[model samples]
Target: MSKVAIVGVVGRTNAGKSTLVNRLVGEKVSIVSPVEQTTRNTVRGIVADPRGQLVLLDTPGLHKAVGTLGTLLNRMARRSAAGTDITCVVFDASQEPQLEDVGWMQRVAKEAPDRVVFVLNKCDAKPFFSSMFREAWKEASTTPQPSPVKPVWVDCCALTDDGAKGVMDALFDFAQEGEPLFPEDVVTDYPRKLAIADTVREKFLSKLHQELPHELGVRVKEIAEGNGRWAVAVDVLVNRPSQKPIVIGRSAQTIKGARKAAEKELSEVFGVKVSLELWVKVEPNWMKNPKILEEMGYMGAVI
Candidate 1:
């Protein structure tokens, strides 16, 4: 039996956590977008190799919890680090590491001092954000450590596939020796319902403006599988009425575009013809509403 490995990928919002996972798995198990806080849940991507199997926990970026959802996401990221054999602390080489980044890493490492690896991502740094990260890393290197796990630097570019294999090798080195964590054919454990919902939400973020993207949430209201096609219905939840127009766009173009893109992607994910039904709902302050949050699959939203 191959050794089992749980590698936790951690970093700030928009630091390419999902992209890196896609690279290792060689498939798009996790959604990737330019928007920050794009991921609000812990997604698992399983990568199988000849020697062993690597089970990766691609978590929401470590950040301050603004409301119910943010708090839960932050908790999820921290909790993801607690029991994992390798805690990969990812950062974008494009931007300087802020105090928040260094501070979060320190605290997480306090929980598992020996397992943290500092991953400086986006090494294909487009000039504007290139030089700034060195200063950031210098700051991190000097930041007082609460425990013995000093952050180790590893650079990678998910889009270009640069230095990514190194990151995988490093993760393997840190993983515990045991049997393969999952069967070879299984790439991710996300339930079809939740995965489709997340896919819809991901498309929303990718296509919508920054300010409005975070205000949106998606839920799969119903799904039915037919002979040659799967029928799926999803509710697009927004916190306020004003944001609806932005998502819907002029003549509802934006909403229609988002739905088409989502349907295409979800079809590929399920490997069949997909009939997607989309509806918009105004869930006043849903981000702060416990019931709504729980219904959205954020069971830990109250943390």
Candidate 2:
């Protein structure tokens, strides 16, 4: 018999949740960005250890919602934590705790205090405050939790993959012995279309910085496969006509750079040669469009 568990990786925005999941999976299942809420979907990154397997759900960081899309993402993140067998919260130790971090602790303290793990990420940077966080959690948990045991705490550097194994180890201890949920040799089960869109959006986000990371979206419209090569077409979505030129850039340089970089990275990630094309389309408030949100995998298809 083997052991298996579904571990929910949750944290506040820009908490390195995606990076740690990719490290644990040993592959790029989720995209990483310096911008907040880079992960807008619930991505399952499976980790196979000699002990068993852990299905890690890389969820969007919990944040204040400005629109319907933002609300959906926050709900997904909270629901992921509520449904999983274990909850692992990643905190950026490089900075002090924020309100969202306290919010998570409060919820988990009242809900599943014992079945939690605190990952003090960015331990590579100094001035560690893991002890302070632990004490805070104790105060938060003791009131509502019924004689809860302390949650496991691990120091990790998600950037360099340092001390991440310890997080997996702690999870394994909590994982019950059972049959494996996923086969070996599979890193993630995320949809291919969404993955491709994420790759393209990642490059776009890298290039544009603070300008449009929050408003724009990516959708892979078509994929043609033949002769061991893939032809992929993607749409860059913005809210208004005015934002179109920014995505296309001066003389199309930004779009071209984003396309070239996306194609190269996607080729490596998917383990196949890819020919990619991009188009910028204006979708006025597409985030509120249920059909568009469904197509983007932000929600299940409407019945």
Candidate 3:
């Protein structure tokens, strides 16, 4: 029988979790950005391998909570770890273990999942602290538990296919014999609207850089579909009026550029001619608004 497993890909923010998931799925199922908290939702990336199928849940990276949204993302990450066949905790081993990294290790040690894979990502970076991560894990495992948790350790770069192959192998090895969770041709089950929103947000993140990443939010209001084409209406949320001009840019250049780039990527991703209508709205403290949060799909189920 072919093996199948649901793997929870969790880690601290910017630990290369999204990159690794995309690499493993062999497609861009999740949006990637160098900005922290780039992934605001739990995206499911399905991998159809010859050995079987791996349902990878790419969750929001754990981060220091700042507002309602930040707390929700952290909760989503921790919750995603439960009820999975395998817990895949990715770490940016290029740097020494941080507090969040140790927090994950401690949780794993205490829970003692049946199968765990600790990925030491960014192995290509200089001063790779693989030994330091190992020591941290050792210290974390000291937490009292019913039994010892022995995790499969894999060094991965995540930026290249060759570097990510070990992660795929390790996940498959722990997979049990079962039928595939999704069809072979299907790579991801991420909602279409959310995918579009993520794509748009990613483009904006690239343009804005550190300007207002944490405060910016994108919500797809509607999608008008016709003959092989889609006209999507999106609301770009900013905390203050001052931030609105920054996102819209001088003479609307920034929003236009981000829109065109998002359209191009969405067209390719959905195999349709995609167009975007972006409306930049200053929704003072939108992150803390429960109604806006639900509308943005942040309050929805994991998958």
The TM-score ranking, best first, is 3, 2, 1
The 0-to-1 C-alpha lDDT of every candidate, in the order given, reads 0.77, 0.87, 0.94
When 2 and 3 are scored with lDDT, the better candidate is 3
Quote model 2's TM-score: 0.94
Name the top TM-score candidate: 3
**Candidate 3 on 1-303: residue-level lDDT in tens?**
999999999999999999999999999999999999999999999998889999999999999999999999999999999999999999999889999999999999988899999999999999999999998888788756443899999999999999999999999999999988888899988889999999999999999999999999999999999988999999999999999889999999999999999999999988999999999999999999999999888999774
Task: Score residue 36 of candidate 2 by CA lDDT.
Answer: 82
Residue 87 lDDT in model 1? 77
Angstrom error at residue 58, model 1: 0.8
Instruction: Please give the lDDT score for candidate 2.
Output: 0.87
Q: Flag regions of model 3 displaced more than 4 Å.
A: 144-147
Instruction: Name the better of 1 and 2 by TM-score.
Output: 2
Better candidate number, 1 or 3, judged by TM-score: 3
User: Model 2: per-residue lDDT, tens digit, 1-303?
Assistant: 889999999999898999999998888889999988798899999998889999999998998888889998998888888767888999887777778888888887667645788899988887877777777777777765554546788999886655788888889999999888888988888889999999899898898889988889998899999999899988899999999999999999999999999889989988899888898999999988888988899984211
Q: Each model's TM-score?
A: 0.91, 0.94, 0.98
The candidate with the higher lDDT, 1 or 2, is 2
Candidate 3: clashing pairs of residues: none
